[model samples]
Target: MNFRACFVLLAALVCLASPALAKTPVIGVNQFVEHPALDAILKGFQDDLKENGVVVEYKVYNAQGNVSTTNQIANQITDDDPVLVLAIATPSAQAQVAATRKNAHMAEVPIIFSGITDPIGAGLVTNLEQPTANVTGVSNQMPMDKHVAMIKRFMPDMKALGVLYNAGEANSVSNVRRLKAAAEAQGIELIEATVANSSEVTQAAKSLVGKVQAMYVPTDNTVVSNIETVVKVAEESKTPFFCADTDSVRRGAIAAVGLDYYEHGKQTGEMARRILAGAKPQDTPVEFQKTLQFYFNPKAAQRMGLQVPQEIVESADVIIGE
Candidate 1:
């Protein structure tokens, strides 16, 4: 072959072999912690995107339960200039939103959040229907009334309910306020215990020992991350522990009627795909997980010295430790 022909062949080989030569989309993920539910959400999101042919170069940053670290991670992600940012929890979402607001370039990068209970209260978005900004995603908001009603079904004559949550988490704080109102409306007293971190969760659960008839856990990232500690205390105290996250049911909560984090992530992934396909985040309305899942643990109930109700067991979508 002539020199020119040989050079042309080499150029074609380089184009085919060098992935770096092609423009691959980059997606930045900011995760609050390595909890089961949040991990499930990330898995679902990635699986959905892969199925939908959305191949993205991922840069995942974990805050590891440090709320302050989220701010630093957000700043680092901003520097990466990814095509989009996926914030996995409330703290992660808030950090990315704050970073976006401060940096002009970051402001243009769309952010999609999952596992956030109260986006408006967190100040991540102005409106749920129309975000009016470059941010919109899924909200894992469970029905407070329904959760209270389920607790009533288990402990019909219960007078007081205990709750453990992270006071610093906006999602937990907002959910606790709603739960308090719901409890009051039902004439049930609520006992609250706040924990700053996972290490303090056991002490927080112990504080509620005789105060509440049953213990309820909200979708607090911090509290849920160390749920086994709370569960161990509740089991020893013979208090039926309920959760607002279905995955916690498997983690030893007596039961839960809640959203599935995997499904929540899948929905959030779809939204991200839409954003990648030229849909504006501001125009895309925020979505809520449509299906409510029932998860009951017979072993947990038995450990709490409570028998699993036949009707509840029959109706549960998943029965852990059957």
Candidate 2:
């Protein structure tokens, strides 16, 4: 226990304090459900972070489309004390925001939410231009007018338009309002069926059969998590089901005019990178997709005994099944 021993301890402490030797920063990613769109967003976020030179260790958790489980995951993530939290969907974001409020340590943890359609309506932010809160991220809000127009374009005789969504998702609820307005303006009746979880999606879709001419799905995580159920119902009912997410078109929806969830995730990751680089969430305005894509499934159209309009087929950005 002489000068050499004392010097060795001092050198170890210096190394521990050095930024180069510090442990990789950890980020918590809480996803509400395991759906293709949300999964793509998660992938885009991680990929973008890697591409942007941000080295982060992530603790990913899935809620499996359960609200209670979502809250539990959020609480666990809060307890882990990650540098930042990325909530994938509206419900997950709401749960994480509530959990952080309950945990004093997590209250300061910056949150970035992706795949949310209505940040302001969901109370996730005070304003889109100025968040004024510790939570800010990308919104996957598609244009409802364009969606309604696309449906009408395909089925010129469409009278009643069906909508199946989760009443619990704020984003879906907000989009439903827009859809209703659009329907009213187009002189089309809007038939609504709400589901609380993925298991109810098929029943909800079935309820729309014969009651409406076609079905339009909002960007609701619950409904999209079980999109195949809705698709099966639509196919059996011979009702063309349209979606607000492009990824859903590939999964069997007849068509969609919207942005890709992967792109939404990349935008979310870029915002997270800004947050990590000392940009406060309160100062960063919420971002939205600037471009949209048209996707259609000709197989789905034929299954429903409908013919894709020549104009729509020509204008589609991506056509499934040729």
Candidate 3:
């Protein structure tokens, strides 16, 4: 070969091997379902990375509130071999964890989860301070005591409380157990309504009417994904509707004492950043949202045949619909 041709080949090889020309890291996001709260969590995670100047490409997937679909997405994500995986809800996290464990190559990839209520109970990790496996992220566990108290404050004469959830979701089941205990301690009967999917949510909400004075919904992906149906049922029946996340208050729930899901996502993202910067998921402790926000909607309360207590109105962190 000529000298000029030899020099040109070497230069081209160097350019191809340059770090600046490397492909962006891929983050696989497996969300259990599409809901305002879960969606906010994803937005916060991406925004945090962008704000910190971390550039990467995202491969996002939604389960559409189906368990089989979540498992399918998990397998696809494992095959994709992304740098990291972010599971938005408990089911998605569980599926990803299982899929990665079965694959030798994907097991090493970090899995970060957000919008989960009970990480320990969900079997994501045995220890919070030091995870026993390659899975750690934020837990948006709502205080059941505070939630029950808030419901009581809104309805002093409440004799029975209704809960709408999906039995398939580990996080929702965990929340229901906590909520049942809390309600029982307050001398309130807890009525349970379980649904298999979003299509069943309307009937579940309808069944609660006339049986309970107030209705409460946990951060169940299936139920929360179809929150408007419950809202309509509550409004028509004048049954007070409460939720476990702040985002639901804007969707016509009377009140909620829960985490700002967007902020919860940011917290999860911060943990992911650490993991990407050489922090192992097993070494990283599970984090919780430090600050909780109380949200109330006076217009929603009126529709539900209730008057917002002045104390709650004054103490709420956010007041929806004025």
Q: Which ten residues in a row have the lowest lDDT in candidate 2?
A: 15-24
**lDDT (tens digit, per residue) of candidate 1 on 50-143:** 9999889999999999988999999999999899999999999999998999999777789999999999999999999999579999999877
**Over the stretch 1-322, how does candidate 2's per-residue lDDT look in tens digits?**
8999999998789878896875778999999889889999999999999998999999999999888999999989987779999999988999999898888887678999998889988888988988856899998887788889999999888899999998988999999999999988998999999998777888889989999999989888888878889889988889889999888899999999988878888888899999999999989999989899999899989888788768889999999877
* Candidates by TM-score, descending order: 1, 3, 2
Arranged by lDDT with the best first, the candidates are 1, 3, 2
Runs of candidate 2 exceeding 4 Å displacement = 1-13, 16-21
| Per-candidate local distance difference test | 0.92, 0.89, 0.91
Pairs with backbone N, CA or C atoms under 3 Å apart (clashes), candidate 3: none
TM-scores for every predicted model: 0.94, 0.93, 0.93
In angstroms, the error of model 1 at 240 is: 1.0
Regions of model 1 farther than 4 Å from truth: 1-19
- Candidate 3 has what TM-score? 0.93
Relative to the true structure, candidate 1 reaches a TM of 0.94
